[model samples]
Target: RGLKFVIRKVTGRCELQRICHNNKPGARRTLKIGRPTYCLRIILCQSALSAHPDRVEKTIDDIMTLKKVNPDTNPQLGISLQASLFQIVGYRSLVAEVEKLRREPYDCENPDHEEMLMKLWKTLRPDSPLTGRISKQWCEIGFQGNDPKTDFRGMGLLGLHNLLYFAEHDKATALQVLHDSLQPKHSKMSKAEWEQKNFDKAIGYSFAIVGINITDLAYSLLVSGALKTHLYNVAPEMPSLSHFQQTFCYLMQEFHRFWIEEDPCDIMEFNRVRSKFHRRVLRQLKNPDMALCPHFAASDLHLVNL
Candidate 1:
């Protein structure tokens, strides 16, 4: 005799929770039952499954095969097993995409990259003319040294891409942040005195260099899967490089504001302030429904409490 399965709505969608088996001879069965039938008590997210019907069906098929092959296996493991399979696939895909960008070393010899670099500089300083090689103006844009190439060594092309994206897409905001980086607010001092103090301090804070470092931080979050919670929610369809770039933008702006507010006494304090900021971001990412929208307020960057 076959078994009769009962589907009931729990929470929001139909779930298969119980199976009634009939052992009587010549009994009409509602559903075909294999030998050693087991009751499944899986509670999958009905809405999520509906959104991805094909994928959910495939996952269910795989689970069904396991039940057939291992009749003695616990049916309670079905829900978690299916969920883990999806998560593993998502993690691998996200990591692969992130790694592709991380491994792409910036090639100075590439004409396209060189042109894009020039474009970035020009966007920041419209009055400045493009140069053939690295110049002192590179320092004006926040490179650590005369040559900007050395700064890209740690972050590779991902750093440059983020810089160019910000400059090209949001020139006004980008220029404003760059200008702010050069001038730290002074308390209880005249404008002339502040300028003199800035000169005396010479803390060597470069806007462009710091932006690259933030890119590294953002990349670390993605690589470490700390970003998966937010990314999964924000990009339910398919996360891409653009989503990562958006995160870079958020970090760049947020860090700039945080730096000004902290007003570190010297550049040596950079590491300490940066660590604090990184921890805050990680805390926000811990939320399951967190999403980093482009228009987030500087003061309210924390995830919404759900």
Candidate 2:
């Protein structure tokens, strides 16, 4: 009327046996479960556990849940639940870090942030001088008006951080993308004609504005966990903000090319093109082995025609 059970741990698996009182020999039945080797280490090495014991426990629980969800599916070919949990936790921590920046409104009063902004502009332009706090030069780079601060209202310091990171990391590529956004080439029009028409047609879209918008898009993708697919495949361990910034750079360049290729009639079609591009990104992320990085091929940017 009573049952006893024993659990045994092995290198790559765990075994559970249910012992029953029966007259027949070999009455014990064993269930072999595929357990990640790390789980056993965590259980045995109490001194080596993380400082946050509760988080470690939660991670173990998540691992159990993951095993339940994908009983037979091994997405990473021997990838353990503990490893995946670490990546997930790292991703969430990064999200929290970025969200903090997003929530923090840009304070013009803060001299450091203000200096960083000017430094970003200088890095992007190089030759052009920072005339003053507000100038037409700001518009040349794609701000809506003479002032750039107003545009960062939505994304806050997060937007500036992304923009500055891209510019500082790869100034040449960032400048090229900015120029391309400003004056996209068309198949029929000459360079002069295209430059003339670019202003009239692309009213609301500009390099700086579009870059900030793409930052928001990238942030949303991270928050929704769609980026986990790519992160898990590319980064075996925890991913950093640099990974996200790299992704933003790719989006900035790719969206510039996509916008030109689509040749929308006006800025009104911005939403339509943006939605289509979002779907494309989601589709790519849906692939189990999709790996995307900041450094992409010229073909990847759709620059073959150019």
Candidate 1, pairs of clashing residues: none
Q: Pick the candidate with the highest TM-score.
A: 2
Poorly placed runs, candidate 1 (over 4 Å): 1-91, 184-204, 296-306
| Candidate 2 local lDDT, 1-306, one digit each (tens) | 011112222223222111111111110110011122455445424422442536645655554454343434533322343444455556667788889988888788899889878988888888989889878778767778887888899998989998998888877788877766666434565677665544543323677888889999999998997887666555545567777777788888778778878878778788899998999889877654565556543212221111
List per-prediction Cα lDDT, in the order shown. Answer: 0.62, 0.64
Q: Give the TM-score of candidate 1.
A: 0.67
What TM-score goes with each of the models?
Answer: 0.67, 0.70
- Give the number of the best model, judged by lDDT: 2
- Window of ten residues with lowest summed lDDT in model 2: 23-32
Local error of candidate 1 at 102, Å? 2.2
Candidate 2 residue 180 Cα shift, in angstroms, is: 1.4
